[model samples]
Target: MNLATSPATQTAPATLTDFFLKWEKSQPEKIYLRQPVGDAFIDYTWAEVGQQARRMATYLQSLGLPHGSNIGLVSKNCAHWLIADLAIFFSGHVSVPFYATLNAGQIQQVMEHSGCQALFVGKLDDNPNRWAGMKPGVPAGVNLIGFPDYAAINDADLVPWDHIMATCDPLQAVYQPQPDDLYTIIYTSGTTGNPKGVMIDYRAVAEAVSHTSVIMKHNTPNARFFSYLPLCHVAERNVVQATSLATGGTVYFAESLETFAKNLAVAKPTHFLAVPRIWTKFQLGILAKMPQKKLDLFLKIPILSGIVKKKIREGLGLNEAVLILTGAAPMPKSLILWFRRLGIIIQEAYGMTENLGAVSMMPTNDIRDGSVGKVYPGMAVKIDPQTGEILTKSGWLMRGYYKEPTLTASVLQDGWLATGDVGTLDKDGYLTITGRVKEMYKTAKGEYIAPSQIEFGFADNMFVEQICVAGQHLPQPLALIVLSDMGRQAERIAVERSLEDTINALNPKLHNYERVRKVVIVRDPWTVDNNLMTPTMKIKRNVIEARYDAQLQPWYENDEVIIWE
Candidate 1:
């Protein structure tokens, strides 16, 4: 079986169907998904998922839906969600997934924009009574299929999903999808701003699966994966959902944030993907329980350090995965090195919704301390040496924003996607992303500092959760830190005991120009709804500055660490 990718690269029909069918047969009994609850695990095999998808596809066609009809799917991560998607593909219709958390208005906007003729909704925490009214505004005769309650609703007005399943034929649909046929419409999280529908052709999704497998094969069969992050984001989607096509590795969905650690032990996933914030919390939480001073003393005594690190890594379910990936934002260098000493290799990657996902990564073999990574296969990256703008070309690149050709042309110039990131590529091809071209600033000393670069400096310390480095026209740099409560208590104690010594011991060795004159330890989190973090978890510099403008001057006036009361 051509697991990595199909041999037919000519964008022909029957090729895609063959690829999926091949997996269904070869891996019929292989467990494809495992949803974790408090104690029990729900397993769904490839054969089961494929069978249900075929039945759903037949039912969709019975509704008189034509080839290439757009189907809306609004739900959280579930087996039915993916099964529904594959069914849409098998039936020759296109899949459109909307985040279940979106408001009714945002939901309608995507429903209209994608021209979704039919929709499938799963269980909701609060199934609003008003949501029924919003359905009429959708395309005419647009059907709504609700899960769990699928048995009761048989009326022509609103068909229950199970009813559709019972009545629709299970035979494979006649129309085979060409590789170039539309497969999905995933809207970006509007992180940078407004959500744009990204139309992904079959070939594009398949190629993304291929490119990822090309790199990941470097690891092996023991590569376990823990799935908790929202699949709506391409980061998790590409690495998890699309990765399944190639690796077919067992996937374990996290039960909830509360059960995250406990669930980690149960699945023992070989690989894991998480946002920087979550990883920080885990590290800090561990420290709160086990202080480094105590841990170090314990390690010095015979036979304990080896046992402790091994136990901790296994408890985190990272014992098998030699390589770990972190992205969606820059992580603190302090945190990165701390994990390194524990025997886990954590690497960062970079990409946006346009280039299909990640563009580069800091390699394991030729590691650059603060950089992301080297470019992946089929990806061409170049820096405008003088201007410092980054450019790229890749097979996984999006064709264009769905129906937004003008906006697409702005970024896709002469086949190279112009990334907004401003950075320099090192001689070894490791790219150091300083900051967004729009965010880098000049200081009063006539020297420039990238907030991201300075952030790496402060984060290198284990006590800091996140640090935003800034000083546009000021005399020196200022750091706003969200100390790990664990870090905060320790830092505060250190300050009370010996402020000058603490600062002298941990502060980054800077060339007068790059050193921060003072630090602000903030307990409050920078979040998306609060306007401090973008949806992708990147620091929103403008928002951070606006919200904390009042405190900046006071911190700058101080020569020592300033505690925000």
Candidate 2:
């Protein structure tokens, strides 16, 4: 059975700029963004943000670019990132955002593919390899505008943000976008091959924010948000940027990775969203300071439970968090339960770039572990019986993949999006993702196995930081694991024993062919810098499999249950 259809398609759509204008007029002095600078925060009121955006818009128009041109934005999360996006909209241009962690080759591919006439460079890491490497990627003719010089970025040759505001007057009339006008192009962080640009229009954004505001319970004004994730990502764009505009909420930016904790404490966000990896790191950090045995014991006492839970909440800067969300990748059920013990309910959400990141979200009142909640109020979802692939449809679905009509036609069939994810919808309407349709592999016995299903079984084992099951053409699948900090510090014998116990507990539940033959613990961790993982922190399964292909056969033939690489 399919979920309910959204009523938003019949209503007059309101663009993001409409919401921004509403707040700017209603509460001009209200702080809309808090940007961290050193130890202090520089607050930008609704009026101030509007003025800066208008000024930038005017400067953009002065460059003689055609209306509705595509402009590129690359930066880590910052207040100016939103401002740049707003400026792109104000100038009647489509904003194309690139992941800040992307290297020169990747950046060039996207910039050229998107046909960006100009590029805005904002706050990035101090590493020369990052900022310096990006410089060579910009095409020779594309105009460059630098947001106030931060980190290692040199703006001497580019137009300075401060100079533009000083010299140019705010645009007298902002460009008004129609419902069908293209708004932004969000490129997917492809696990394999080149990224595809997802084209979204103003109408789609309106539908997304309208439904998301109600589903996420962000209807009230003055909500607080912390922005750290890449705004380029569809999830972060909707949750932090679009939601703020929809609710007139305040958004705070993290200064850097080193100061993320300190900045989070300052913001005390009312609604928080993080990926599963971040949640895991938080759990590991807590266990590092206070042993799990002690934490579990403290919670058994009524009085100490309150004190301990409150202290932990305050320490994690989630003291005021009313809604906590995790998504982008599947979260382990064990990890969710672990947080529940501390009185923190983490709601898992499911979405993709094609849908503007609005799909299924776990409800606060009725959360089912291992399920990504029910479909959004206006969306419909169903499982394709043949492929076991999840299909969803909503008004917020993307226009199509930019400049890739054949690819677009392949995924968008009639009105339904053929989400490549495999999932099951329960009687209660909750969706449990099983695996990706493209991620399935065949063993030498010609039986197919979904690696995600196997890897998820190992999530409860803290010793395993990251695991990928791979064994194409092999007799049985092999598990490749990267040891976590806790695992590395523990005695080798203990680590081996823990892994063996996990294997014993999990193997019985799997099919004979799907069972893992051995566990290979690799020394190097998968990271974005190494290209073994995406910027969003999802492991690159194909890359990992190819990297250790030769070892797979050798490891499968080994006698020991655990093999060190």
For each candidate, the alpha-carbon lDDT, in order, equals: 0.69, 0.89
Listed per model in order, the count of residue pairs whose N, CA or C atoms clash below 3 Å is 9, 1
**Model 1: per-residue lDDT, tens digit, 1-565?**
0001112233322234565576688889988778775698878788877777888888787778778888988765666677787788888888888765565566777877888888887633333443453454456667887654322133356666667677766765445677678777778876445679877787766665555555655246734567766566778777766665556667777656568788877777666676778777767766767888887776676678788778778878788774578888766666677787777788787787777776876677777777777767656778876667888776667777787899889888898888888877765566777777767778889987777766665543566666777777677888787766656567466633343344455455656777777777776888654557654566777667767778777778875565554
Give stretches of model 2 more than 4 Å off.
Answer: 1-9
Q: How well does each candidate superpose onto the true structure, as a TM-score?
A: 0.83, 0.98
State, as a TM-score between 0 and 1, how close model 1 is to the true structure. Answer: 0.83
- In the order shown, the candidates' Cα RMSDs to the true structure are 5.4, 1.3
In candidate 2, how many Å is residue 478 off? 0.7
Clashing pairs in 1: 224-270, 224-271, 334-459, 334-460, 361-372, 361-373, 361-374, 362-372, 362-373
